[model samples]
Target: MTFYFHFLSRMTLALISVGLLEACNPKSDTPQQPSGKEKTTKTEMLESGAAILQSDSPLQPMNIYLDGFHAAKDNPAHQMEAHHFCRQVNEDFAQCVLFDGNTRQANLIGIEYIISETLFETLPEEEKQYWHPHNYEILSGQLIAPGIPGIAEKELMKDKMNSYGKTWHVWNSAPFGKTGDKIPLGEAVLEWSFNQDGEALPGLVEKRDQRLGVSTNEKRNDRAELKDLAKPQSGVDALKGKFSMPAHPLPGVVDKKAAGPK
Candidate 1:
């Protein structure tokens, strides 16, 4: 009977030991499954990527170009003019225009130059481009609205190959291999002639002339008249012209007069 009791005691001890081992290594402890909360957080991040791309951060590669004329691009005004020309094409076609120039947004006037791939690569890895790689560099500056200030202004339109929400007015043919080996002088003139026909050339010249306060056409007489009326003169005349006048003068005219006399 004592031997039977001893055997039963040993069996009971063995059973307890097995139960302790099982408790230490729980059956449900197969590597923990991801929590529902964690999965939801990841999903939210994916959905927000698009909005992040369009944000004002310089890193985002929106089509907006700033005035780079203050930087390293050899000629500033000519560069701006080229951008302006493309703007005309973009506007006339009601299509996106690819262009490049002195973009004010960059903060560095003459030192910074923006390129297509450079801008696109600036975007974080998640967002997709509106154009193919080849299509992006070559036709990117093809204006959606002629001379629309890309980064300078915000508006929605199909630009070049991309139906983008906003873009800057500037372009580059060299980086895309459109300009060939020759960094052509007076390329702006050639480009103007190459792309524009009929009255387009005259219109561009007229626009430039107006920008400089030099008239290229007699039709500018109307603009000239408007310019004369917008000037602020002594006391009462200055107040009436500046504040109460119905028709605002063309932009540069007021400044031009202000420089000359009282």
Candidate 2:
């Protein structure tokens, strides 16, 4: 218990320091141009007043921020950068609000609910199809907490090992290098993880890295120690052989069910 509290203290301090430094230069990756009439001065004033008077208790708990990429389950070609503002509900469960960008003008795109492997095992087989495995996301360093210190980020990833996430993207308002729908359109689509290298769209991850001043390769190298914590996860092979290029398996990521008998 002492060690736990000590670690928490260090994490808190690191977050505070990093937050202060990053405030000077905030980064927002996606550029969204949702079709909407410009807000009038009167409307802006009302919003400013509401911000001061309203108690956003529900949103207050959403403290953790993460950036990752997601591809449409049925179509690997459709991919986008996902910014997650998550609230940890418990030791084994979390819920996140997804956005296309990380700034005030960003569009709300979807939601994702995450659960530990233990909690996931309790779900029905039919329901399991909706959840995607997270091992590859973490091990490959495709998921990141942008403004946090390296130690804090690693600890955060360590806690999420072997977890599963069920994500539903409701808006097609912003996609990589293209003018998306003027407004949200069509049915909500299920998003999946990139299980292998060469699966993500070319130049997709690069643009995000350039904008955020982070490196996926560096992150992947730093997280090498966490690989030992990995277990064969479900959905790791769901998009196998789907990419145009020959996909290569990420080290330490495996899908036992997909592998069959040894």
Candidate 3:
């Protein structure tokens, strides 16, 4: 009987110790979902890069959205917003981390690497399939930095106009209507750009403008003179443009005015 009582007391002591541990650590019992006000683990991981960024850091992170359809034939246009922290990895090459749209708590969704046209032209035809021109993105105002002045934006685009971008999106959030994504789940997709009006959703751009407090239409109008700028490799297909892309689900494609990718 005495031994039984001792075992019961030890079990009670163990339970009490666990309770004390719980008391010491409020989050020990429950997992934490990142709140809007807090920087998520993913955001921290991505932003931690800023610490290592060169003091001259060619480009600070700029928030922008790209409107396009997924690689699937039936997929409709979705506005893909990303915060690009562009840093020069070398003299003529730069790399960027594409984080989710959330300014406060973003997750790393993809990556973009930019190279000068001089360097791009050196790439063999087959090798070019992985890259896309930035002119279409720049002139159309689809690639925008919100709240910046007109001249500042123009200069920014001008610098990027001839560069080439290679992007791969790992987080597929279009099914959620571009709302939210917690984890980087599912297959990685080769992302494309909306080269023109017919290919993009009208409302998505407006929603992005309102949410971001910038005007895509105004930016588009300001860039009218830039429309004639020659983007030679802005081809109809990713291969023609020399954009390297994955085989499955087609490639990061541009649509011809004819039937639309359906």
Candidate 4:
């Protein structure tokens, strides 16, 4: 998800595509014999074939599950749900691979890399433009790690409130297959967020809050003080705005494009 990852070789790209295809299709210990046929687990598939390719890559054994939205780069108004599988490679950084919501045969959608605020500060100004703050993602409850306890999630969010993320969405698969293809297709887009009250996705957040049994509005009250800790990059405000930010003042531009056009 780095801004400069466009330099990857065709060979490396081929390996990533194949390795991810093999690894992302997770399997269960429960028998998969509806018709008495045996289906291999994602782990097994990787070991048998993708292991070599996966070995060449940094991410291994993706362990965490998170759900968040990706704002279409050309149109920040279009927020798309991204199912994530994350691997924290080191103490300072974690990279997440995003998939379609369909856990069954979920397609590779995109990726995001998160880094601590300290690390973000060390980056040069040009590089900083690629990162966005986690303050709203946390306080607004837009970022969630599913299948975990609420208390644990709160603690986790506390730790990540000041982190910065660099994201790129490569696949444009529609939630309802409304775009017509099941294949991963399209150019990569830089994502944005609904950091303000009126900018939120109505049905999207409503259903997510219902499923998680939590209120995003209430999280705002809970993390009222956390607002003082974040420092979003300059370009982040260009898409999400910077009205009540803790970060230094920066340029701002609201994305005018929409998913289905305004």
Candidate 5:
């Protein structure tokens, strides 16, 4: 009887101790939440980048209904309801080259999308079979992340200062050994540059930049005419001046293009 009483007392004390401990430090089964300071810090970091990405007119104007520029306009009401939604999302899609200017672990926020079909028709069989848009992978800074001066990774070093510049990082989408067989939705590579007025540098980003496959030797569809001019007149004389170039899908790529408001 004494042993049983002693054991019961000990168990009661243990329970009481546990209750005190829980009272002192409440246990939460839920995931740990960021403190106010931590959340603010994160929000600031994300906002800083999103602001840069949404700083002004996008470097490349989207042809779609809700390209980067039109994001705000598309859902003003929703944006008002959600202060950081569009901004954060836009920045997220744009990709971050470096965290706080660090070059390591480039965070992917956006991509240079091109469909595989376009490349299929444009690229030769050898280049075509291997480079599928879906298989094309992109590095964070290659497209939207700011560019670095002096060191050109994929293409020309024209504005090559070693400072941050923006260019789309183009890649062969093919996974390690597998080649893609379908027409990829995001296929094209683009170079993004901003003008002094904060407008997208159309000539630079769309036509001149090499990262988007625009070089002196390589020209986009519109400039294909210029390519003809560069070629010797022998081929020119045999060919009509007309040349058909691939059309870039407008920027807003959400399905049901006609479904939304105009």
Candidate 6:
């Protein structure tokens, strides 16, 4: 009888302990489904072990995160959101790996290398065609650093003014009106910035804003004081007259050469 009572008490204690543990560490109501393939128990074990054992020194410095939109240079309407995991190489240079989304399941779609105007000027005139200016992206507030304070974001934008980015999209991972390919396909294409209003597909920015809980127009207004820091940038007119709708001018974003002698 005493043995039975002890067993029952132990079982009750175990059940209560499990209930307390579950309450402390609740599972997500909507668990994340990363990638199409489900992770098997073996794969999950291997991944967890590798994470504990592996050294990720190279990836450690990719701390800066920025989200922006991109359009194909050859086809302006082929636009998509780019999440940048960047490493600042120096005062005048930075490099980024572009992803389709901010989540871990996001597809690695492209790369972009940014340089200061001084570095950009040193490039051969022909080489300049591949790079797109950033002033419009900054001033229009389409580019943002999620989770950062507004003041810090604005300061980051100020530093990026007059810079230029050379980008290439290697994967058509997330195309509009179609399911994204499971693997990368097609030739890699040059991507450019939205230099003018109405260039991005309708609802592209809106959908992104809704998902991220941000307002592009609000950021644009907040950065109005930083307008004075913007200098005319190269490639601002690269997509001139490309969109179906008329271009609406954004103040403080200008093409360097266009702003110069006629």
Please give each candidate's TM-score. 0.19, 0.90, 0.60, 0.64, 0.17, 0.83
* Better structure of 1 and 6 per TM-score: 6
Model 1 CA deviation exceeding 4 Å by range: 1-77, 80-168, 174-215, 229-262
Whose lDDT is greatest here?
Answer: 2
In model 3, what is the error at residue 94, expressed in angstroms? 1.9
For 16-121, candidate 1 gives per-residue lDDT tens digits of 5667523321121111122234448777787589567657643322223211111012211222233321111122122223323223221111112222333444
**TM-score-based ranking:** 2, 6, 4, 3, 1, 5
lDDT, candidates in the order shown: 0.26, 0.84, 0.52, 0.58, 0.23, 0.78
Q: Which is superior by TM-score, 5 or 6?
A: 6
Q: How high a TM-score does candidate 5 get?
A: 0.17
What does candidate 2 score in Cα RMSD to the true structure?
3.1
Q: In model 6, where is the ten-residue run with the lowest total lDDT?
A: 24-33
In model 6, the clashing pairs are none
Instruction: Give the best candidate by TM-score.
Output: 2
Deviation of model 4 at 207, angstroms: 2.4
Candidate 6 local lDDT, 97-206, one digit each (tens)? 98877655666788999999999999999999999999888888999877555776777888888899999999887755446666777899999999888887888889
TM-score of 3: 0.60
What order do you get sorting by lDDT, best first? 2, 6, 4, 3, 1, 5
- Per-residue CA lDDT of model 2 for 1-262, tens digit only, reads 2233235445545656767635633578457687779999999999889889997768766757789999999987889999998777777888899998887788899999999999999999999999999988998888988776688688888888899999999997677666787678899999999989999888998988888889999999999999999988888988898877778988889996966775
What's the true lDDT of residue 14 in model 2? 67
Candidate 3 accuracy as lDDT: 0.52
Decide which is better by TM-score, 2 or 6: 2
